[model samples]
Target: MKTFQTVRGKLSGQILLWVLLAMSTTVYGQQSPITISGTITESGSGMPVAGASVFIENTSFGAVSDFDGNYSLNAQLENKDYTLIASYLGFTTQRITISITGDDLEKDIVLAEDLLSLDEVVVTGTGTGANRRSLGNAVASVKSKDLTNNGATQVDQAIAGKVSGALVQQNSGDPAGGISIRLRGASTISGSSDPLYIVDGIIISNSSNELIDLGGNSQNRLADLNPNDIDKIEIIKGAAAAAIYGSRASNGVVQIFTKKGKSGEPKFTFMTNVRLNELRKKIDYNTVPLAWEVATDRNNLATVEVERYDLQDAIFDTGFGLENYFSVNGGNEKTSYFLSASHLDNEGIVQNTDFKRYGFKANLTQKAFDWLDITGGFNYVRSISNDVPNGGINSAYGAITGFLFSDNSIDPTPDESGVYPVTSPLVARTNPMEAVDRFDFNQKTNRVITSIA
Candidate 1:
């Protein structure tokens, strides 16, 4: 009877201990922590992107990438499924379904460049988006680097020879004058002849024709824009390519894209240039006699006294120019901004005639939300100019009627009545100094533009 009682007590005690061990294990399993580690790289270059964020989909557990794009996290659970998210600016997000185990987990992920992916998308003729491979019409794209390669002053000049099936001609070498562009020959005989210019999704009025007083004579509107500020230019040559732009685009369309900020540290740039201008061709006056000899030769026909005047020498002077530019660009993941200022001063080859301009520009873009984006930009300019009078055949400085050669004895100085002394009509017609003093004109322009997407 004593042996039976002892055996029963020992069996009961062993069973109780087993139950306790089972309960302890259940609690410990719930409390064990999990470790996750991963490395991130660019899809194309296989280059690690440091500072990328890696975290659980709906939890606070997260880690920042190190220099090698490696990250680690500790979680207080095991044998469970969770969503892991990795993100970096300028790259597409990466997600993976991961089941945690008691042991440490490792993963390697690659992210695609978002800009390259977005660029591949194409837009249909009906304002709908399509892929580039599916398009049927002829289309071309001009990159920003290509526009900036050659030092061109105007965007039209940059595209002159670079593009095919387009004709660009400069009618004259006048500074700030217009350039003529014809795509596939003349479509209209009496109406506007130049192609329409679109800038940053806005239809800007190009006054190349109006600049010359409705074809009377004027400068090209394209020359008003500084080419250095342009990012890219796209040309639509065919009717099929310009169908989306509506009636205004019948003559073809020239689209311009300006520079914007990128995701990077703030950068500052400065550029300056100095140029000298001289007469491309010199006039010959050796065949003409002195003003006195001419006056003596015409004595029989002259009723009023003829004085000497050196009009040719008084009209021309040495020309010099200077240009300066400074800019800054920077941005965070959500917002980017660009600011620039420039100054241009050009002295004309004609005495006392010159042009000066100062300009300011800014561009700002913000990712207001996940599906909304906003952009705004502005340009302001102030200009002052002094031009010689260009009138009829007898006009003082008309290129066609102005005398290239004049007699040497004609003095340009004024007489006692504050009036320029008159000499022979062929030798000296008007005082060039008087014409410069009387002609002066000033103009200023300011432009503002904004868009949302």
Candidate 2:
């Protein structure tokens, strides 16, 4: 019985020793996690590209480069062969075969510039993703150079006579007059004919809603935008382009993209503009007093000679405009920022009529994750105008209407008390000179547009 127990204990001890040896061998044979480190740089320039995405292809293991353009990624894999990818904006993506055989790897990647990136990207009303050549709808694009180089004070004026298959018409000769654009003709007979306007991915109000009764010559909301801040304008003029935004794009869509910072050192820009406006020509007034009085007198009776008065100088003057704009833009690969401020004071040909505007805009873009990017925009504008009524409705108090119906025989010079006498009974008891001087037609608008996407 003693020999049997001893044999069983020896067997148990041998089995335990073998198990311990196998466990130790297994633990020692395992390899460490594979780490891939690299620096991403631009081709030719050799500038370090921060915020670059570096990862193994078809795998979740990835890392974004730090500000120094250095990145490190770790992965535990059973396979020895894999593909590595490095990508950044405005540069061509690079992929190379990498073999990780139980050792850490160091590989530097250089990406070439993507020359076709600017031409291929399209800003549709829905969003910006697809290439321009891939779209089936007819889209008209106006770049910043075309829009801002026209000396236009208003955004609507910048695109005037520039877009194809669209009619841009000013509502009146008033300096702050509203603009009407008809894309695909009038959408509704009673409603607005203006197309929907989208700025920086936010649908904004381009309403011609008359805040005050300026005889339908009230400024449109599009005037609030600074023309110099516009980067691009895209118009989807076809109805078939509604695959993304549904019925809201019925009247066609106008997408406005503001300027953004480029990947480089900080750049500052300052612009000043001076403009002068004068009457093109005067109307042929009846200067012959004998012809006017003799032709009007039906009884062939001798009447008092009619005096001719040149009131054109009193009603019109050379308008002067001064504008100043300043902008600063800068960024690294990880983030980019743009800021701009502008002020404009534009006088009108009509006395006591002018438009003044103050504008500020800021845009920012940040790479939050390998697959995610965040962009934000803020725009603020305040406009003040000393407006004068001038439209086809012919309001009784309209400055132009009063001038039209007034008799030239009576002088419009103000009296000693600074009160103007009524010149004619035809103008609905409203004096043109008084309306131009003391009508107190003032309109002010403050608007702020913000977006995050």
Candidate 3:
């Protein structure tokens, strides 16, 4: 009787725990989602303003204005009063406060052009700053809008083609590989041709860091920077333009400004993107068999015509990539804060090649006293990639040689067991498909940038 009573008590306790969990879930789910519908238009023209950013304060609920300047956002009815903000690239930001009640809400916003863009403040090579109109020097400033417009996975990629006189080329097709940025032309034959990169008044290295097995593959450190965290960039393309930075700026100078908190209610933003990479051009191969091209059967020693294999197509395939970012910027009269985090996963067109990165940043500023202002920031990034080897005749495992050396008759397709059998006698290198899948070339790095002033 005592044992039975103990067992019954344990069973009853487990049942009670489940019942409480279900009850809490029911109560939480009871909160209905509120829908906010609105149309955005230009103030002067009364025309639709599409692609405007609309969001609720301090929450992940947001939507973009459609082509017709119409937008609708669903917000959870957790807060009694919510602040909604609408922003556009060339217009002033608009904010409205409201309380969520029973159901749907309607709001229409009008934005006026910001003339201040003409006289935008610009930081120069010298310690002094001036507006764009006053400055006589030739300087290129890239802002947040330009960076995010193309959805660049790497910060350097965003500047490519966008900056005039800049010749930016990625070293390899590998997503995480190095980038070659040449300003104007090479200034010196011996010195480093790469420009000097400065972020938040500190110099950052952009040298290639290649390891073993990867051969010539290298990753430029600048590729590690998260594009979303940047607010603006100033590029001094020529050596003369970077005179203030001294000799180290021989290659030119690139100054990066990180995003800072603005004085307003807390605001939240989330962005996601997906991209596909396809092989547009393939090497044309001779489909017909070459005369006198014959191979002997291993078992019978009988000569047989070679079978053609489209190794190029088998080696290349469609690639996909994904990116996600979240940020919150807000502050009060004296204190301000900006926090952001992002993740990227890029799959390369070549098999077994991939790049992944994670980034986080936090900036805080406080006006402790009238003359004593303080600022601090923390940044972190983690990168991972498979450094696949390139094709070359010198390398025993060169992937390219597997296609060139083998006769067209040899089949390179993988079998049911996912193995590429090396059946040809002429091929000295490992099967290209097998080599990429088997080789273990990986790159990983963790970096942190912090400041306090």
Candidate 4:
């Protein structure tokens, strides 16, 4: 009886100890994790600062504040005291010593204004510009140096391959040809897809008016504006631009800012440049001395010996271009003025094809009152071109068409009488030498643009 009582007492004590151990482990597993939470506010007005970053120093634990300036971080802290940091844009960063033990800690951080922070100013299609950091749309800006570095005389040529999602296409190989731009692909099938152009807040025409047809080739009026006079260019595309510019900006918007006078003594600048344009590749022509005889009946044809002539060298030549630009600018605290002039001459690869342009510009600004300023701008351009038919379908007088459709047996060199013989009688019915030498086509334009604000 004594042995049985001792065994029962020992078993009951062992069960009681195991029950206490399990209960202690359950309590430990149910304990909540430590968390650090805080609200970030401005120092002066105590306004909640959203999008602020709150983090623990030297650790990967961090969180961003919500719209209400509330933030929470789960910290598996190994140290007794940790350094909490809060940082925001245009605001001074704050750091404080924090302690996390067995309970959650609440911290409220105040960020002071960073007086030295300067945001970039960006043109947002509005009269008053906005900060670049605060804008949500994509806006690309190109400086004058970047636009003119590639020896470009025309504005379209200067912007080629410099902007994102902007495609520039030359319609013809003529020195004074038109350019087509597609900002967001073909937005409309029948309507014009060209982007709206604004120069110094004034809408300008970019139409390609062809007074005479040169095989469907025309000149864009935008070429009249010299690239040297540009200060910068801003491009805005997609729905963001349409909301501000309406249906006219369905394709995009291009804003050009001309150079303005600086507040200093008079400054003069002179620049001259020369460029060369050459053919990329030549077509491989068959130089064999044998060809199929031109028999009226194909079944009764015979091989005939002939002299194959190569006319590519005679049709194309190295092009030359020359440009001169001059400018003077000056201003005081109350008044400023800028004046510039430029001249350009370009020769095309085809013989007797050339382009010339003369441009002048003036900009003036006056401060009438402490809070008001008046500005005005004037621009003039004269363009002349010796054009040729180099584009579109098979026209008998087309420079390139006549050469491509001509026979290798027919020579393009003029005879002792200085008369060019027909090269393709059945097809183009014109000779390449005649088109390049005798065909005279001319185009001239005089335009003036003015703006006041």
Kindly give the number of clashing pairs for every candidate: 12, 0, 4, 0
Model 4 lDDT per residue over 115-150, tens place: 323245556566656665665556677888998888
Of 1 and 3, the candidate ahead on TM-score is 3
lDDT of 2 by residue, 357-431 (tens): 999999998867644568899999998988877623456676676676667677788999897877655446456
lDDT of 1 by residue, 167-280 (tens): 888653334445788865688878876777877677777663322221212555565566667766766676755567777777777777777765446879888877575667
Superior candidate under lDDT, 3 versus 4: 4
Give all TM-scores, in the order shown. 0.60, 0.71, 0.67, 0.71
> What would the TM-score be for candidate 3 when compared with the true structure?
0.67
Top TM-score: which candidate number?
A: 2
lDDT of 2 at 362: 96
Candidate 4 Cα outliers beyond 4 Å, as residue runs: 1-121, 130-136, 415-419
Who is ahead in lDDT, 1 or 3? 3
lDDT of 1 at 418: 80
Ranking of candidates on TM-score, top first:
2, 4, 3, 1
lDDT of 3 by residue, 1-453 (tens): 999999999999999999999998887786667899989998657799999999988989999999999999887666377888999976868776767775889989877564333236555656555666555445687888899898678888999888888889876677787778888687777876888888887888887556564544678888778988998888876546556787888777888888988657789999999989777788887576542423453555544455566877666778899999999998864788999999999888777788999999999989786456588989999999976676565666645556666555666667898877773466566677666667778888898888776
Worst 10 residues of 3 by lDDT: 290-299
Off by over 4 Å in 2: 1-121, 125-134, 241-244, 291-303, 391-394, 427-429
Q: Which candidate number maximizes lDDT?
A: 4
**Whole-model lDDT for model 1 versus the true structure?**
0.64
lDDT by candidate, in order shown: 0.64, 0.79, 0.78, 0.82
| Superposed Cα deviation of residue 366, candidate 2 (Å) | 1.0
